[model samples]
Target chain A: MTDYIVPVLLFAACAVALRKKENAYDLMLLGAKDGLKLLVSLIPTLILLLTAVTMLRASGAMEMLSRFFAPAFSVLGIPPETAILVLVRPISGSAALALGADLMAQYGVDSLVGQTAAVMLGSTETTFYTISVYFGAAGIKKTRYTLPAALIADITGFVVASLTVRLFL
Target chain B: MVMSWIFTGLLALSLFASLVLGNGSALAAAVPQGARDGVNLVLSIAGSICLWSGVGKLMEVVGFTGFLSKLLSPLLHRLFPSTRQDKDLGQSLSANVCANFLGLGNAATPMGIQAAQRLAKRSEGIASDELCRLIVLNTASIQLLPANVAAVRVSLGCQTPFDILPAVWITSLCSASLGLCAAWLLGKVWRR
Candidate 1:
């Protein structure tokens, strides 16, 4: 039900814009060209981040990190499996989503781990990817303070999602 | 930059760890597979980027973005004081925020890129505070509905896909607010 809002809003916006008798198609084409340009600029950074994350995961570094963090995460009321999910989440949404579904399958959806995964996934953004793509598209060379700030937010999201899941579910 | 260090650090760590853990084959496979995944992700998102960016362009042309800017100006102005003086920047940012609020992350990218581009124009080699703030905000986007997460839950056969709504609301709000605050504070400290 909530999914229709964006598509409907987009359709209405296009209709109204077309009704203005302006060459909306030309503007849209220009925007699409910009999107293509943005995509091209983003590819390198995307590949870099993707490769790095993949290597980290494949090398079992994420597992080690999760194991290392489990005690601390447990102290904070998070399950060990969720520690890795939280860590990987801000880096890649798809990776996090895959982990999230696995967690749900391992634990029932109503379980604390499953609900926490869902909430954590919902709360956090793909921080690194957003930074890379958005900043890359803008051709911003140096990103100062953004990464730390976003990571701090990621931490806050992790903590808050855990607490909220406990409280609500 | 800091990002380069992070990338290198992660890669070096992964390589060293793989050697120690004897996961050489998996590490070796990751490189090409990762590139393929990256390309696939870009391709998958490209169509939505074109469509939504096109629609965002139409909204800008029809003055809908202007209306959105006006509506969002108070909050956006507070968060992005520099944007108050730049109408184009504010409009693009507002449109991006609106799309993000609707959980239209793919649709929001073009406007975010447009806003970033506008902010980058005045910046030299280093990223401006405004650009940094914009990136942080986008990274901690506070969505009213997490449609994608809900959809995934439903596909997993959850009886109530949206049951996590309250948690989502709480978590997103906390992260976004805290992120913006951290960015703002850091910017002040760095400028001084």
Candidate 2:
């Protein structure tokens, strides 16, 4: 969060410092306006994610799926709670965040599951949603190498998350 | 439009899948509930994502991006040394990088657009830098520690919510490194 504060100021400073008097105020205003549009565009997406996550938790997918995933992860030293994270990480980023929060709450952050979720958070990409929004917005009809590449990166993150937590936790 | 439709359909499919997975014997009875719940879930997630996106934009308005640029300047220089100084592309890259790190991805959308705008200017309509390259770069794997993730850990009542240092460092290091390498390779191929 500390890293976040100054960048907001950078927009105004960059506009004021770099642009002419005529352009400075104008560009900043345009940016501000576009910023709002950007925000507005994402509402439906967020609402959908939250609803799905809540429903899943209510549905007992959290408990049932954890059992299935626990044995698989034991080989990697990851606790089962972290399994829910890997499940949601791909489909919905917000859900994953919520799930991680729940895991943190019950298991405690010092626990291996909590630690693994933290690492997993930083490591992986939000594959389906990001691909859809980014490329869809750009009118990119095809991803070509992008899909495989993103997956490889995701696998690497999963492995590293497990390995690091196992070694350190 | 096609992609959107596909995604919507997939959401529906995932919902059905969840319903069946949960209620194999009572599929007909449960399907409707699952469908309604799934739609509601998607809507909620959409709202939250928009909220975070709004916050991220507010972040830009208040000048948080510039500071992030300076702070992450060293890493940016090392990662993408080819990017020029005094260019918004670098700033945009830094912004995207920062958003990814915070797991404020919906927020990173604007930064990606900004970076693309900069890249477009740098290429001067030559298509030399092709659009996908920016996407790949923006999609770079990030390393998050004391983030929404740590908050989750804390809420879950973990002893140390910030106990993910090892995983954060190692996983992010590998994923981001691989992302950069593959992206660079793809960029080279595109250039040819």
Candidate 3:
């Protein structure tokens, strides 16, 4: 963590130096321009997630789902919020992150829930939702097992975040 | 309406499931948490959206993105042979590539959209191979920095947020490589 700034600075420097002919700050500005295009595509996803999140909360369905998954997650040192990640992945990453932060606040850091939320945050990619929205807009006719591979990657990330946090943090 | 209702029911179920893990008292406490989460989610998404849109319009004006896109031209040229190697598509793609590396999801989404839109415009009468390839590439992107992941780690109280940096690069690169391979194979086998 202490050395993070060094790498970030170096990255900025290298990214700048490598493009010596162009201005580094300009690249950043360019990066920001790129960011805007992403904004357009993500609007629908945000709407979907917000609706889903609000409905889920008011309906009291979150509790039931949490109870069903608690035993399994508890065994792994995870709490309710962590289990939400599994369900939340198909919804929206940013929303899932919001929920994860919520869980962290409740369970207190160093608890299983906080750790799991952290890991889930780092590990998984939104599959059914993000892929569909992105590829759909792009006019991709075939997914070609892209979803399966990403799911596998998400699982790997979840497992890694869990074990690493447990052992190291 | 029926499908939306069904989705609403399903969402209700997911919420029900989220709550039962703790005592009912926790649910009351969770109200504020939910509100806070909602707000954060909105802010992050909005921040990302604003940042990226500005970036997109800016790069076009500055010409920096044009320079970067040129480097990928040889590969892009081959894949998108049917479409002319024009600047708009290339610019959109360069912006997207940079956004992905930064872990700016909201920003990447629109550029990806623009790239597709631009390609569609260029393709005119024919469905181009490069366009298909780019979609796969977009979904299976490498995301070199994984800033979001590191930030999550830090917030979770990790001594070092970037401890997973090496691991992320390796995994994302490998996965992206595989995705590219799969895309290539799909393009070849499905070649028309």
Q: TM-scores, in order shown?
A: 0.68, 0.59, 0.58
Query: Local error of candidate 3 at A133, Å?
Result: 4.4
lDDT of candidate 2 over B1-192, digit per residue (tens): 443553464345445656767654443434454445434433433333333344444444555556667888887776655565656567767778776665555567887776655544544433333345455555446644334454344434444544465557677778767765776676677542
Off by over 4 Å in 1: A1-67, B1-70
Candidate 3 residues lying further than 4 Å off, grouped into runs, are A5-83, A102-169, B1-11, B14-25, B36-88, B104-107, B121-129, B144-159, B185-192
Best by DockQ: 1
lDDT of each residue in A1-169, candidate 2, tens digit only: 3344334544645554454333444444554455456446544554454344444444455566677788887776666767767756866665566556445444656666656776787667677777666665554554556665666667667877878887876
- Candidate 3, residues A1-169, lDDT tens digits: the string is 5376435644644354455555645655666566555555545544555456554555566555687788887675555556766666545565665556556555764566575565556545665665667566756565555555455545545555566666654
Error of 1 at A11 (Å): 14
How far out, in Å, is residue B61 in model 2? Answer: 6.8
As for candidate 3, its interface RMSD to one decimal place is 6.4
Worst 10 residues of 3 chain B by lDDT: B51-60
Tell me the lDDT of candidate 3. Answer: 0.56
Task: Give RMSD to native, each candidate.
Answer: 6.5, 7.7, 6.8
**Model 1: per-residue Cα lDDT over A5-123, one tens digit each:** 56687678667877888787788897778767766866676666777767877898867877888899978777776876776687766556555655665577778988888898888
Candidates in order, interface RMSD in Å: 6.7, 7.4, 6.4
